[model samples]
Target: MSFLRQRKTTSQIPLYTGLQIQTSSSAVPIQIVYGANKIAPNVIWTGGFSYTTEKTKAGKGGGSISGYDYRCGFALGLCEGPINAVGGVWSGQSITYLWNLGLGLFYGSMPQTPWGYLTASFPGQDLAYGGLAYVATASFDLGSSPSLPSLSFDVHGLLVGTGLINSWDANPALVIQDLLTNPQYGVGFPAASIDSTTLLGGSGGSSYQAYCTAAHLALSPVLANQEAASSILSRWLQLTNTAAVWSGGKLKFITYGDAPLTQSGVSFIPNVTPIYDLADDDFVISDDADPVEVVRSDPFTAKNWVTLETLDRNNWYDATPVQVWDQNAIELYGLHMDSSITAHEICEPSIGRISAQLLLQRSLYVRNTYQFKLGFEYCLLEPMDLVAISDVGLGMNKFPVRIVSIEEDGSGILSLTAEDFTGGAATAAAYPVQAGSNTALDHGVSPSPVNQVIIFEPPPDLTNGVAEVWIAISGGLAPIYKLADGTTGES
Candidate 1:
């Protein structure tokens, strides 16, 4: 027969539903995929198990089923290629034959399997897998391949392909021999040959090469020993390992300089501890003699700006005596006189001048351009504290007061001398001048008169010895006096 175009292996095969079909007693371990056509068609049973190995003629066929649902876990990777059209015939092909054409089962254990081997036979194979079983076979009718109705079974230790289980290989005790042997002959067959050229149809004639090349690649490989491969695999080649590292290929390390170091040349020391670490505060300042920066919002006021020194009267005769740059630094020390003034004995002043020295830091004089005010208050404390006798008289005046004079040379001293009336009767223990008896006679005194000649030193910074003057009378009434209209009169 000429080789004809054969369609891909049974694509419409329904999943095995674990429905058992009765078979002839002569069938060794059960034709799990058999039907009236004498050969079962190919079909897949997802979520089912099948045995990958079978027994020999000398022993009953048996082996553990290898699949996700099998007693022993096995993973099968079906290659993405066209499946074979030969089905239902139990082609009696070797494991390599089925594998070369992108069909086979991956056998392994759940936790682990120390050892395993593939098996096949013409008939009389035993079942060792414990789970639902499935069988796939093909029937070509009218030049088209249609898969046979699959055998549904709960048979333990059955065999299977990635997509389906072969019908003739469904015996409960089917061995490798039964799968490749003609059912009628109980002898070795060409399909069961272990010769690599005949089985995998490869020049190298190796089952490993055929199986490995034909198996579909896994997206991720479940490892038998994760730690071993993890240690061997290069990080760059590991698709699942996504960690990134810097130049040194080590974890990150960071150091910070928080404070000055103790070494003379070093500016800072690394703070080994983190910010939250309490012990990180061991750093010290760089130098012992370091200046601090101060920012002032407003200049100092009277409460804190300047400090005062003692006053000086020794330079009372000097022109530039109190060399004070700013008067704020010059303080006067004297008896705090009451706000009262009186004339005792008409001129009984303090016996001698009171004096004190002022010592100040030289900065006060060097920096000039400052001003200040010296303040004092004087008032009459007793009546008759003031007396005035004019050129006309000195109370009962007789002598004529011709001239009156006053002088102050900026020496802080004032000299006052007045000429009184010459035509006046003398009074007992008083000035001997009288135009009237012991009384202020208006007619006997001149309108403009000089009765008192008082001399004293003025306060600091005097000009022309001119100052405000006042006098109090018997009623303790004080009236300011000024030189006006050729006379010292009340203003």
Candidate 2:
């Protein structure tokens, strides 16, 4: 077998590098060395080789050769072979001894027949139970050859077909967590994680023209569909809980809308047949969380209801039954859709241009950590670098520490940065940051960074009182800020 190592074989043989394997007589040992190619810095294991031995038997009429003869062979490396062609690197790590790299390919497999791919690897690897072997293997057909692949493809295609792809960027994510946690990956847009960016024409440019044009061309139809659905939600919200009688019990809600409340409304309103069927009107639950026990009111006063205000009547329609237990807590029961709700049930609507107030309580927000000054007056913000900051509850901590960072990138794109003062991972919370210049908190991501720099690559050309920062921390700890000397009315 060693002979093959010395005298290489033909170019047709496939040899794996970056690994060393010793075969018992039947095959020769191989040594893989990386960093041999200068032109291709990522190229690993050049001049690597493999060998094999063959046993030959003598014919019955053999004279001099009565026994079997053995032969060994080897192969040489080509500068353009697959091994030396594919490039990759583990930044900062120099001598990387790769144990196994299951044929370098997408979705973990080697390309077979250019369109199809195959790969072998052990996923549930364990040494005690002989885990150092190929455990779970996966292969995929990339191209449309077999006609029908699977449901995942169709579902993915449908989602991509929708403008939902614009929800994220195409910057190749390194891992699932990167796709989930990285804010830049999704431009801080809600549902952008599960969404795709490639569908956005590959150029997620930070320009009013770019996004506006893209929105005009791409999101219009999607938004139209969304508007239609939102209209339906608004209509549904206008419909009373007459479907069922209202009673004190475990409410059963069903979302007839395509999307859930998280998308455009709050929570999905189960198809609740209020025990006492009353002609449904725009009922507002004082408590957004647990609407039960909380009083429900008409969104439009009887005076306004008579006029039948023709609002968007499609996208912003929302109503729910809420009971406030305290200034910070509430119990929500019944929910209704509004014209503002989107088609996607889980996708939070873009609170792009709505006004807001500390609904439950009214107190001034005074920052404690640092203060800053913009002009002519004692800077309210300490470091001028900080534009606006929010004090949010970061679960397990006493008070909500400042988080998200907002910055103007001079290019019209808004960039936001979040910090983890809780000593947890910076990714403990996931929310959108692709907030436009609208002061309204509607379209922005919920449970977002309370205090972080939001840099607009290009300064937004619009303004409103609601275009403020919002952060949703884990454990439902929504951060709130108050003046340092402000007294707590109630704990």
Candidate 3:
């Protein structure tokens, strides 16, 4: 384990997928999603990636015509498996298009029908991207804009109850565990390599899954194609202060904090009890370095105010920002501010407010930083494990510390860095009461192709040779009538 100075493995992931850029490349990989995510599909079939421009007469006379209306046609690859369904299609980041407007969705069904655009463009090619969810659009109107708009989708990849846990889709721990262990469309880690006991919140500790559900911090993050697994894992860990280990050839996952004291109220285990009590004699004797160095967090690096921004489920998943501050700390520290963005699918104000409060409190507490070294026998100690330090030189007695970093060297020594910790410091208050507007309606569903048409050319005296057509429909939605011909009609 001396090779523990490992290089980061998740450098490829983007910070937040508030926008998923569409890519067109031969070597680009398709995504394998678990649970739900907002994804930007890869362009797998660009054969129909053409456009149309229309310039119509302004006010029934020629010459001074209206600007051109550009329409684009393309096919996109979403992810593996026959997903539950696809929701709205977002243009760039904000504008969302109705499903029936020239957009077609296939839920990665086996033996998928060849896409209409594909079948029409290349008559003999029957490449259906079988067993892969995708979207095909025959025409997307740009309405006086020449450039094609960027596109993304809201997709629910897998939501079946496969006995992993009750409502696994809503439990991030269960969802992540399933993703890593499932042989299909997952990283496919071997069963034996996983330590399921701890990951499922077993033993004396509370489950991470329960905390997420109670905190309203469940995730709907996009795991786009070509993104490394380590990136996704790292993101989840950072969001919840979680840690994953591969000790003894068995992988395990642990969330740093204990379970919420109250499922819905503002409560969290910021720091656990110390696992080991260490003295100067327990540290590895070094000729060139000090074994223990007491540390107080750098005040210059401290923050009294924290703002958290993430999706607000109560507001149609709109981006919401919430700020919390330590009034006394601001008076003492002059208002140092810090901001963070998370991808969790939050639904309550208390969730965001409580999380921000935690950050602010931790900043105000200014946890200690302790640097030390220990022999290989102490290699089992992982980051986040609380330790009690008793030092004669500093006259410190059982001082609590939280490990934040660990590095191993060739000399079979563990280099560690820790900060002062108290479980109470990071526990703050929040209310489940919502503080936002009502949510927008869900996206429109794709309607069937409008095939029943009745054309009437009236007589000369009948309405002055104008053909007036009227139809009645019932229990129906606004028709999704964007067709391949680039013409639109309403009933």
Model 1: per-residue Cα lDDT over 203-299, one tens digit each: 1222221211121100111111223322322221111111111212222111111122221121222222211111112111134521111122221
Which candidate leads in lDDT?
3
lDDT of 1 at 464: 65
- Model 2, range 367-440, lDDT digits (tens) per residue? 12321111222112111121222222212212222312333334433332322122221111122323222233
Could you tell me every candidate's TM-score relative to the true structure? 0.12, 0.16, 0.63
**Residue 468 error, candidate 2, Å:** 39
Tens-digit per-residue lDDT, 357-408, candidate 3 = 6567766774577898888888889776788988887887888887878899
Report how far off residue 90 is in candidate 1 (Å): 22
Clash tally, candidates in order: 62, 112, 3
Tell me how far the alpha carbon of residue 85 in candidate 3 is from the true structure, in angstroms, after superposition.
1.9
lDDT of each structure?
A: 0.22, 0.22, 0.64
